[model samples]
Target: MTLPTSDTRVETTVTEPGQRLLTVDGLTVSVGGLTLLDGVGLTIDAGETLGLIGETGSGKSLTSRAIIGLLPTAMDVTGSIVWRGQELLAASPAQRRRLRGTEISMIFQDPMSSLNPTMRIGRQVGEVLRRRGVPSVEVQRRVIEMLEHVGIPDPERRIGNYPHEFSGGMRQRAMIAMAMIAGPSLVLADEPTTALDVTVQARVLEMLRQVRAEQGSAMLFVSHDLRVISHVADRVSVMYAGSIMEQGPTVEVLRRPAHPYTKALVASVPAVRTRTAIADPLPGAPATPADRPTGCPFRTRCALAHDRCVEERPVLRIVGTDRLAACHVAEEVSR
Candidate 1:
């Protein structure tokens, strides 16, 4: 994603009532020789879902880690991550920890490890309450309510079961309850529905929506599945090789995508019962951070690449009303 120029950030996007609860500005993440994220920026509003979609190895998950301060020690991140007007990256570790799992919670992809094998689900969920100094009676009640909220069949029984005792889908529900029990304002859901039966996936997603609706929590949902992202996200940001290629309202960007990469990605989703279907996947694989093209990281894979694409890096300039893309040829591509 092309980052905001220093001057651009000075002119903050016009803030409506509760325009943003979280804003990441010109964030860059590097691990020794590799630049995992290059100037990625995004905003998640209160009570909104922002779908962050990208292909595998595109740094989608990495971006999530950087937000929650879960990246490995080797990676150095520089940028401003503001939550409720307080800078997260700039905050002390103790301060960040205080905010995490209470003000901001994240549902990690793998539920097995996320939930301790030895701990019962109820205890894990109540741990947050304990840390917050809630009374034991209230913690138990909240844990049971959370279990039921995620649609576990037998909430009371399942609450006492260890992680290993629960099935995959059930384990996921437990994880969701744990992440959400604190009633965080922002929830980072990193592919929480992947690899589940279609029916179960729908249920989980619906549960996320309900959680947001009932609690008024904002969400940043990361996924490679554009289809799934489109279903849950109000706004969408498409990423490629650790940068946002295009971003706008979900329907607008998907219907009239400005970037060549976004167009290819939308076309590539496998649909049901389509005859003579052909997915025009982008021509070349995304480059590693170290070897990105001089002018455009996506230039080598773009069908509309020109000499200038290889000589002058394209910034993510606004092309449409309320939309941004990092492609010199977006205007012509739309034509």
Candidate 2:
């Protein structure tokens, strides 16, 4: 699908009357009786970026998939996904189809797979424009312009190239261009730069931030890298065992984490200039949803674990101004 050239400058503010763009409330996903996401909730306001950060099995990607209605049919999903005050989970397939691309778009983790292998890069991008009823000639012109906007050199010449023709970094940039070309109200980026080199990753992150800002788009940026989240997101949610352990402003949560799991994650990030020895890695493997502990899922790996943590699950509680943490000892941890 290709976006129309004339529609390139269309900027839509998607906030509800309360200024909330999207809200996931009490969302749960279970596959074959094994839960993948358990009562996860988060929100993104108009033109704001919310970072979903956690280790590989923490249900970060699952949460994103649920929002976009991309989860497998076999998965048993329960909960509400509201976008602009509309319940998305209850929306018909046709409605979701219409909402996708024009209202919401996703930059998938793997650019190679997300893009059509047989289609030329230009056509694939133009397809989005075409879906919006763009004329063929205009699609081609805007495709090249978008390619150039993403920093692809000599886009007019490379427009005919296939996905394999572009380098890894370029492919990622192309994915970004495709996602943002339509000026979606919300953009969900699922670890879009995971496969790129650090230099390329930085560039892609910068491009994502710049394009989203220019388009006035709200973004849900999913990543396992706290460093990346710190650079791109205004606020962040830390997930563990399919639940949000802590959430607050990115700077506050990164600097003074109120949850034990969040603290461990911060400690694990390597310091660039300091000569300090490597910190002790978090103990124990991440728990699968099916095998989660009786009470706090992170209790098994947390040093602050006590009888209370084993007997009762901690609900998200106010820990500071605009901060929430699901830890029994959040006060002690923050101190």
Candidate 3:
């Protein structure tokens, strides 16, 4: 199938609220001559949830790490990561350290691994406040309050327990408490519910939303599950091979995906009410960043790929009122 590309520009009508909190422009990450991320860019508004969804090895977690300056020194990153109008990439290590946990925080995928086994739950959560010169008494009080707020029963007693003492759900909740205890302007949640059961996952997601609402924090929620993204994200960015395939408001992107990769993802989401299975799950494993195709990274697996897709890489362009897609046939797919 040969799908024609659209040349006419369409103005985006989606009005994003709040001030611009982050702008990642032309972000490229490389390690040992392998480009992990290729010119990836996105904007996050204050108090907005930008869901980053992709399969494993799509560089979703890497993007978050780059933003937070968590990447190892060996990896070379060339990009502009602007946080609240300041270029984070250019910021000093000490400056970044101060910004981390205070202006920005992250909730890792596995709480068990993220939390120090030797440290007490209260001390871990209170560490952020303690570092900022908050009185020991106030730090203890806030730690207990945050623990209780995250649905941990008997905060006073449980605060003294170690990571092994808390249940999986409770451990995840403790991680959430630690992330939000500082009341950061930005929060990066990398699959926070990955290890939890469905019931616990639901509660954790709800708690995350509640905490975000209370703190008014902009969040970068990364996950491979579209269903999970649909519930928690206000906007969605679909990534493949370290490149953004599509991005827009969550509702529109989920309901009417403009990119073939996104369509495949939406198709793969099993329906809950009817319990319908995905008739055609996407074929082939996702492309590796090091071995990406010259033109379109997804062209090998794309059904509608034509000569144009094989010869010319398509950059993200306006496909709908608010959507941007990188596929040459994005408009055709949307129609």
User: Which candidate tops lDDT?
Assistant: 3
lDDT by residue (1-335, candidate 1, tens digit) is 11112221111123343457899988999987788899999998887999999888888888888888888888889989998889998899998888778878888888887889988889997787788777787778778877776778788788788989988888887788778787777889998887477887887888788767756778999998877887899999999888988989998888888998888887786551132466655667778887877888888888789999989888888998889999998898666
Q: Deviation in angstroms for 156 in model 1? A: 1.5
- Give the C-alpha miss distance for residue 256 in model 3, angstroms: 1.0
**Candidate structures ordered by lDDT, highest first:** 3, 2, 1
Error of 2 at 235 (Å): 0.5
Against the hidden true structure, what lDDT does model 2 obtain?
0.84
State the lDDT at 200 in candidate 1.
Answer: 76
The lDDT of each candidate is: 0.81, 0.84, 0.85
Q: Tell me the TM-score of each prediction against the true structure.
A: 0.90, 0.93, 0.91
Worst 10 residues of 3 by lDDT: 1-10
Give the C-alpha lDDT of model 3.
Answer: 0.85
Residue pairs in steric clash, candidate 1?
A: 1-243, 1-244, 295-313
Top candidate on TM-score is 2
**What value does the lDDT take at residue 123 in candidate 2?**
86
